[model samples]
Target: MDVAGAPRRFTGQYYEQGRDIFTDVDQNTFKAVGEEPVSTFSIDVDTASYGFVRASLNRNVLPTPDAVRTEEMVNYFRYKYPAPASREQPFSTTVNVFPSPWTEGRKLVRVGIKGYELPSASLPRANLVFLIDTSGSMNAPNKLPLVKQSMLMLLGRLDADDHVAIVTYAGNAGTALPPTPVREKARIAAVIETLGAGGSTAGAEGIRQAYELAAQNLDPDGVNRVILATDGDFNVGITNSEELKGYVEREREKGVLLSVLGFGMGNYNDALMQTLAQNGNGNAAYIDTINEARKTLLDEATSTLFPIAKDVKIQVEFNPATVAEYRLIGYETRMLKREDFENDKVDAGDVGSGQAVTALYEIVPVGGPRAFGERRYGTRITEAARGNDTEYGFVKIRYKRLDSPTSRLLSTPIDRTKEVASFDSAPRDARFATAVASFAELLRGGRYTGSMTYDDVLKILGKTRGDDAFGYRSEFDQLVRRAKTASSMARLGS
Candidate 1:
């Protein structure tokens, strides 16, 4: 799956024009369970970071350290977790504990949330507003061309009853097409084909117009969403990320969500894309090739366009008597305060139909190899957990149904019942996730990976590729090799 178009040096960083913006985030550190036993973070289903990393590798460059988001990388590939019995529950949670392949005496705890899958016939009408960027910066072949084609791919997925609208911005914003039924597919495609790149970017205006269109055509029973396709270059009108996020949030409150599809390289603004998506109650994805467009728009059409659950938050509390230390593998930015889980006013990530979001934690059990020494003068371990000493942790999830503002809670315990005999005996999905997380960690300087190497990553990937019907996991194998090459090239300063 050559998701990146024609390669430059590695993939997404061919130009090196030095305008790509990614927020530098620090790696998570292990904490003694006795000190802070609770871990809280929102569920992230976005795959933008993985696509960006792959694009960089294809261009012969290893991704910038900040560009390697372990959570997005780990969540990019679909895992075969069991679905909820019904939409009433919305999602199912799966937990597994296995030995950490990277180091001895440590273990990996996997928490997976698989959203309920809905048959196409059961989905509500889709009210989609295509907010496209036609800025001069998007003139590159991979930018606007792919954006237009990506729109077509999504158009092909909509039902006749679905509605489509187009809003584009360069120096200014304008509607290329009004809200039209998918029954008029030819009209929609014709409008998309006519779109071209030129002039400065007025992305904020484009978003406003798109959201307005969606709002005006609000379907009480339909899923209304604004899909923004851009290089994330907002050169004109309300370029401030916070302001734009606030704007998106306002519209989200009115029932119109946003999803950003980033394209191109060098000058991409992944940070802004994330801000918009995160606040707009949507997800961000990068499309570097037609294959990626297909994966995001066609193959995962329902999941990409119709969210089944919103404001989903996960909290895990380690039993101090059973676990000594633990640290989350990714989602550094989505971390929430302990009280946010039950707060309906607090915003969190949304889960789409059939979307599976997985999170990993590296933990040291009591009497296991500890990452940090016991707090010499800290509070002593208590007997409060005496009855729960057999449990490694407790997992709690809070989520709201698509139509509700109130949240509900679901929980399960991570105990011996969830532990695998060894890494080799762990679920393939869990192993594969760990492999991806390890690879991402290596790319980000391997602060915690210790002796893990590309070879080790390949070893894990080789054994856990599963029956990758879509070849997604097989693609990861190639990416690992590409990363190795890119590392060598970087060392030589090629």
Candidate 2:
């Protein structure tokens, strides 16, 4: 124990509705127990409200085949915005990696970019319906009220040519405003402001009404979407999970995208929001503050409204000889089946135009013959005498055009014999990603093979801070200090 009276250890975790309980064991390990163990989870290193988890695992306790995907892990790294190649341009790639807090000599990888390729936002006509949940649960200061304010902000940003509608749900769903041109800003603001919170949550009915409004106002060449803002609490109608997923999936086929912006806390359903966004061919974001709303709706406006690639999947094959044992840092839930890479129907992440996605792998150099300590040498019997002349496997990416189902493939070779050390030759984005990953591990309980710590992670990140254009690097350093202090406090608590 060092300072703040918290335990310095990773014992285990037990999570339930609205609360997470962690037990301290040693400084290195933890286990989750309560309300079932969630596996697929997304965390915000900056804002703490929008954490997502899908803990569905089989009896074997390993992540399901469809649950693990490389892109999910890489996309999960959210540090350093991709720089625009030029002030006039919109997309640039940035990569960063920092030392792992749990694993010695290993690093966390981050790849990101600011995408300039704003899809043609010039939709001939856009029919946007807002599905809002105004239940009593959303009475908090940051709940429905903030949502309304945010919508108003978006309304202010709309063009006169765009069409907008509003649908609200409490015990039942109903449309408060019909489709109208952006010229009627006053009327739209009036309708939005009049929305009040009451009754129990009826998310399904709201979804139905929003989709109906969208389908009725389908824009042949414009953007037709149902933007659902809720805390994902469904008590009245259409509560069945699979049924809702199917409904949203079918609606997506109509060329109407779904964008889910989750608001509020307490009983927040990250799983439900994720499912809705994934199946609806859209993205999910939790709005904890007004700044987040501005970032999502205003700053990254084009990408949020238009997509460049859909169903993006990444596949990386490692040479058995070059890497002894490897594990993905985060995205423990988005792992993919090896064959699923070629399957087009498999749902994957979407990449906005000019968006830079990055992933990293901790590998052991084959040429150096590093000390692996024979962890799995005798665990499995030898199969048909595989040769040792293997080289680095290929890294492949698959993505479909925003409006098409067919996909395109991009592949790059990973030279096995080259044995590049990540610490020395890592790109800028890689270094950033590494720092983010390390920071995440340190924040959560990281029990890794590398024996990395928060102090080490900060050192690595500081060296490759890059241009610090958006102050993200400065923010990162602050987070590092906070984490270090928290760890010390936890130690003291123990």
Candidate 3:
């Protein structure tokens, strides 16, 4: 788990200088349903946390607690939710409650959202700018070289109508390839292959130039986006986070989206990359290997590129009659004020085509033991005061169209009747997601995981890993085993 040993696994030699940055945020705590019945937060589709954890474990290192986001880990795997029947709604919802595997008398409620799918033939033309970082820090094989390989995988899916451009930054930013049609595949491939790594990183300049090119050769009715591939080592210019965020916000108003593809590890600036991607109306993902590249760029190409809805936010109201205390599993970074949910100006996450986003809440029902503490004494509803025995809570979602400014609202009731008799009886996807979420909690100090151990996680994952076509679920199982071993060794060493 030592940092000094990491580079040896990937390369024989190691560099002593690298600046990786992450933000420290407080984790969510339990809430009394009687006092605060409503929980509001924005949707997050970023998968970087999962990839970063995988990279650290592969190097025999345990990821830092701050690096883990439980929600991202849960959403990394696809859930078998029903897709939306029409584009008018853009997404569908599936809600279910099951007995908690980790805690007795507690329940886990899952909210699943699946976006509408559009076939590749029906997908709009793409106007993409590949913003690459070719800095000295990216000299390793996993940095710039892997970026080239990842881009090539994406090229295989592009059509004749799609256009691509390449932009790189080091001491300065410049164009490596002008806007070219996808029909000129050989030319694009040649340009990508010739890219090399050197010089200091000027990430700000690269971002500006890439946005300019995307705007200049804009496809008015197509998917206009800039994909930034980097280790996120921005040393040269505009290092101030607020300044960079403002710049990205302005460009986002110009109808250009920015999706970040992170590479390498030692000097990765995850906080900065995440900020840019979130404010620039895009999703951020870390590409640690060629297989991850294929998963991001090819298998989930539609979800990665074609966004069906923007500013997606979710809010849940727990009935005091049915619940005592509840806590959201993760999404600490995406928490929003109650009023922000109704405010159209407040920016939030985007839902891409055919993507599934899941959220889990741990709830203690009325008369159940208080997991955190005694509930606040207030006006209590009697059985006669409760409206319906079947209704648990209400869920509301608000989102805007890709081109619209105003937002529309969707509301549904979460029924207690949908609760399964046991965790073993829950759908495979729900059980598998819970397993991943629990695993994350354990890695991040196990604050809310109760009695869940690494062995329990493995058992749950092994039993519920249903139909993993690409072996992502299987890979996750291996990761848990590796993490268990690393954690045990660390404890023994201490």
Which numbered prediction scores highest in TM-score against the true structure?
A: 1
Candidate 1, residue 145: how far the Cα is off, in Å: 0.6
Model 3 misplaced stretches (Cα beyond 4 Å): 1-18, 380-385, 489-494
| Per-residue lDDT of model 3, residues 1-494, tens digit only | 11112342212111232345555677898898877889999999999999989998897778777678999899999988998899999888899999988778888999999889987678999999999999898999988899999999999988887999999999999999999999999999999999999998888899999999999999889999999999887777787677888999999888899999998777787777888899988999999999999999999988999899999999998888888889999999899999999999999999899999999999888877676566356767757429765767889999999889999998878897779989999889899999999999998899888888989999998899889899999999999999977885542112
lDDT of 1 at 202: 86
Better of 1 and 2 by lDDT: 1
Model 2 weakest lDDT span, ten residues long: 30-39
TM-score, candidate 3, is 0.94
Model 1 earns a TM-score of 0.95
Worst 10 residues of 3 by lDDT: 8-17
- The TM-score measured for candidate 2 stands at 0.75
C-alpha displacement of 156 in model 3, angstroms?
Answer: 1.3
Candidate 2 off by > 4 Å: 1-15, 19-116, 119-125, 367-391, 416-425, 484-494
Which of candidates 1 and 3 reaches a greater lDDT? 1
Q: Quantify all predictions' global Cα lDDT against the true fold.
A: 0.88, 0.58, 0.87
User: Which pairs clash in the backbone of model 3?
Assistant: none
Local error of candidate 2 at residue 471 (angstroms): 3.4
